[model samples]
Target: MMQLSVAIGDYDRNRPLIDGRAKIDGVDPIVMTLTPEEMFFRAMRHEAFDICELSLSSHTLRTARGDAPYIAVPAFVSRAFRHTGIIVRADSGITEPSQLKGRRVGIPEWQLTANVWIRALLQDEYGVAPQDIQWVRGGLEEAGRVEKVKLDLPDGVRIEEIGATDTLRDMLADGRIDAFMGPRAPTTFVPSNKGLRWLFADPTAEAMAYYEKTKIFPIMHVIGIRKALAEQHPWLPMAVYKAFAQSKAIALEHLSETSATKITLPFVEEQLRRAISLMGRDFWPYGVGPNRHVLEYFTASHHRQSLSARMVAIEELFHPSTLETYVI
Candidate 1:
């Protein structure tokens, strides 16, 4: 069996594989549970892992440049609607998305998947273009954050980088930045901090409505295998895909047990039912065909945002072997 080092986030859907309950057919995976920050930086900068959960935006950018180091498998390890990521100062007067024009907004990185989705939605749904805001880039809570990959921003889109002493949380708290957006809420967004609030008062409703119209949950991360390993062992991608699918299945099956909740959340059953009612049984799908629209939209957004030179097709991103599966 080929020994492969894999870097991925620790989530319930991937827990089975991480704990050795679900096994890949022909490979021995040395799973290293790492935060997305560490994993992405290492993978993109150093080719540190044989397999990794890569940011969809960065991966798409690399694919467009024809220099991607990893072949993606259609296993979407992370997906979320990014409406909740946008946080604004209560006094900013940014009650609506349209109000954000010419205002200062801070983000952890320009190429972050969450930021990419948020920017896309702002333009597509509200007609607020990227050039409309002065973007401030820096860490959310800590200091010394930088974009994992170099960016080629479009003209008229101004981006300012914060020094190592600055953070988005402080900037927002001190009224230095008008708003902030990222995957996680900043430390200053708690109830005690009356200064900050979500840009959308009720982000869940906004997200649901957006999903109803666009049918995109916004895929964040894709499972990637080193290109050399994938080329040397063509079957490796399928094996990884099957294992991740099985792991997700196991997690879903456990989540379906309503007698006692598997998760700590009180409304797991209601949330599960709501998800099914809204999207369908396989709402968090893992294959290419089921997710073509999402992939297309994201890649198009990547190109439009100037992160990619051209829009990368869905077929160009994922390994062909994992695109189709037997329906026995």
Candidate 2:
């Protein structure tokens, strides 16, 4: 069996594959657990791993530029609604998304997948376009953060980097920036930093309503394999895809055990039932067809945000081997 290294975040759906309970056919994967920040930087800058979970926005930009070194699989390892990711200062007077116009906003990266979705939502739902606000880019808590890849921002949009001694968290806490957007809540958003509050007081309802209307759960990352490896071993992508699917299947099955809860959360069964009712039994689906609409929408958004020169077709993003498979 061929040996390869895979870098991905540890999550319930991928834990089985990482721990070896689910195996990829004819491949020996040396799994390296890493955070998304380290993993994306290493993969893009150094090609450090043979397989990795890649930011969909970055991957789309690379693909559009015709320089991506990996072929993506249909496995979506991370997905979340980003309405909750937007936070504002309690004194900023930015109570809604529309109020963000002409305000100073902080973001970890302009091309981050989460920020891409959030920007799209702000534009589509609230008529707040990217150029409407001044953007400040910097580290969330620490100084000296930079975008993993170069960006060519659209004309009329103003984005400036924070000073070497400054950070987004500190700036937001001190009212230097009116709002912040990224995947995680800022370190200053805790109770001690009472100045910070979510832009939407209750983002859950907004997220649910967005999902119910658009059917987009917002895919954050996609599985990527080195292009040479995929070319050399034509079957590798399918094997990896099947293994990931099986792992997620096992995780979903475990969630169905109502007799005793495996997680610490209260009312797990009730939450699961509510999710199924809202999104049907296959809420978290894998593969291309089930997620084509989301992919298309994100690609359009990426292009609109000036990350991609043009909209990339979903067919160009995934390997042919993993596109269609027998079911049963």
Candidate 3:
């Protein structure tokens, strides 16, 4: 068995893989639990790990250019609905998505996966196009952040950088930016009482409505294998896919153990039932076949948003070995 380094997040779904309950076949793996920001930066910039959780938007960008350092598997480690990504100044009076037009919106980076999905939501759902608003880019919590990958923006799509010392959290609080949009909410947000709040009065209701309408649970991160490693070891992709699928299956089984809730939060049973009713049994599937619509939709959004060189085909996104499965 070959020894390989794997860098992934510490989410419950991935715990099995991290702790050896699930193992990548034919490989002795060393795992590092890392933040998405750190993992993405190191992987994209330096090829720091043999396997890592990659930002979907960054991967798509490199794939479109035919220069991706990593060949992805269908293992989407992070999935979320981006409705709660946008937060507005409490006094801004922005009650709806449409109201975002002509306002200054702060984003940590334009090329972020969550930002791509949120922008897609605005354009496709509310007819609010990207160019319709002024985009201000800066760090969410700190200052002087930059895009992980260089962007090839479409005409009329522009992003202005904030000062070297400015942070989005501070800007939104001071009303310098009308709102902040990204996967992470600004620290200023306080439910029912706040100087900052979600643009939607009830983000959960909006996200539920969106899922019912579109049938897409936006994918945030994908598991990637170094291009050279996958090319040299032909079996690596399928092994990685199967292992991650097994890890997720374990998590699902644990989630169903309602007598002793595996998750830390309350109402696990109620939430699980609701999710199952909405998305069915294979709710958070990891394979390509079960998630082709999601893949197609995101690729379309990426190309349209000027993040990709072209509309990348879903088939071109993953290795062939991981694409098809033999059913028993």
lDDT value, candidate 1, whole model: 0.92
Could you tell me how far off, in angstroms, the CA of residue 23 lies in candidate 3 after the best superposition? 0.8
Which lDDT value does model 2 have at 120? 96
Candidate no. 1 TM-score: 0.98
- Tens-digit lDDT track of model 3 for 1-328: 9999999999989999999999999999999999998999999999999999999999998999898999999999999998889988879989998899999999998989999999989999999999999999989899978888888887998789999999988888788999999988876677755777788988889999999998999999999999999999999999999999999999889889888888788898999999999999888988888889998999999999988978898877788898898899
For model 1, the stretches where C-alpha displacement exceeds 4 angstroms are none
Model 2 per-residue lDDT tens digits across residues 1-328:
9889989899989999999989999988899999999999998899999999999998999999999988999999899999889999899888988899999999989999999999999999999999999999999988999999889998889899999989998999888999999998886688777788899888989988999999998999999999999999999999999999999999889889889997889999998998899999999999999999999999999999999998899989999998899979
Model 2: residues with Cα > 4 Å off, grouped in runs: none
Q: Worst 10-residue stretch by lDDT in candidate 2?
A: 185-194
lDDT of each: 0.92, 0.92, 0.91
Q: Model 3: runs farther than 4 Å from truth?
A: none
Shift of residue 292 alpha carbon in model 1, Å:
0.3
